[model samples]
Target: MEKRNDPQLRLGEEFFNQPCLSLAKAFLGKVLVRRYADGTELRGRIVETEAYLGGEDRASHSAGGKRTERNTAMFMKPGTIYVFPIYGILLCMNVSSEGEGAAVLLRSLEPLRGQTLMRELRAARRKEGAPQLKDKDLSNGPAKLCQALNILRCFDRRDLASDPDMWMEREPDTNPAEPHDIVSAPRVGVESHGEWAEKPWRFYLRGNPCVSVVNKDAERQSGSVTDNVRSLTCAV
Candidate 1:
């Protein structure tokens, strides 16, 4: 398929005006565009996502209809960017959906453009003497993706459809000669939430090397386990 060199088109608010699960599934294969202030652009194809059922999902911050300074964006109109920090340092990106508190978390991306810039940014974040980032590992996680794309706290609550710096674009073609198979599983973490953690809301491209974590066993586990594994892992 020929790369689309024309000006990218941003997904409209109507595109996000749907049920959270539907939006999450539809988001796969779409392209995320991040234009820096210097006219450079970072691009990636959406490969993984997780749906948050707003006021109904225990894992969602908007559960029980509680609104705070951090989650107010989730209550806004569809296509709003709901960015928040996890573990104090990592930033996660979500797109607000039709209903209050409904959002879809962007889990992983297949780097499509500006990989050199992404690598530079990722390397800069590492502690002195830390190993450099691998190409596939650059945007494999929510926070790592955000960092690679230069998305930060300033981007929280931005209107994705209208934002000049960032927006999501539709997949250029649905019938690429080689089509990607869609796969679904429960989201990573949130195992302590009992039944809510069992929701199979995570979706990704089957066999995509860019996919982050795909542990079906852990995905099915009801309790969080303690593992002494060392690994590095991002969003928007």
Candidate 2:
């Protein structure tokens, strides 16, 4: 177990300087830590990820190597955070991977520390008044997780390896997730990309309630609709 005051074991730049697909799969079960200005820390375990290959991949914002203000972070060094807003309302988080133009979107996570803060932020963003939020509902989607954690546009292009506010860590004693424990499917909300939409780039932990979308088999077995419900698509 990690000590309360000890610095978390963060994944370094070298860890993310690999193929996006590899990094996407490896992200599962790792912990995402958010250290606020007041020193309050929030934690969650990554449960789902989607890989976007570089320029050749039509679905990627960096496709065709076109550089734009909105996608500049996607070309930054590995381990950089690429945050962007969708519909001017929701924020999505992704980590730059490989050398350039490739990244892995963080699709969902299981809430770990600071549940109350996550609930408060989530409730504050919704139209309805304060209400009970189930653990799974707290951070089951990319945008939802960002809102629950108060992650905003300011975090865009931040270096995950060195950023004081946000970073990813792995437990020293935790075993890597086995093949049977992972599921890969076409990325969510990328059908508009034609052939690229069929690529099984979305990876999620099998049977993890925190995953945004459960595989058909997992959903059928779970029976509880909420447990395996798919999240609403906001953007890629």
Measured by lDDT, the strongest candidate is: 2
Q: lDDT of candidate 1?
A: 0.82
Candidate 2 matches the true fold with a TM-score of: 0.88
RMSD of each: 9.1, 8.0
The total of clashing pairs for model 2 equals 0
Task: Look at candidate 1 and give me any clashing residue pairs.
Answer: 141-234, 142-234, 142-235, 143-234, 144-234, 145-234, 146-235
Across 1-236, the per-residue lDDT of candidate 2 in tens digits comes to: 23343454788888888999999999999999888777898899999999998899999999999889988888999998999989888999999998569999999989999999999899888887556899999999999999888898999999998888888899779998976577878899988999999888899988889989877854344344333343322322
Residue-level lDDT tens digits of model 1 in 127-169: 8888877778889989888988988888888898788889888
Tell me the spans in candidate 2 whose CA falls farther than 4 Å from its real position. Answer: 1-8, 217-236
lDDT of each: 0.82, 0.87
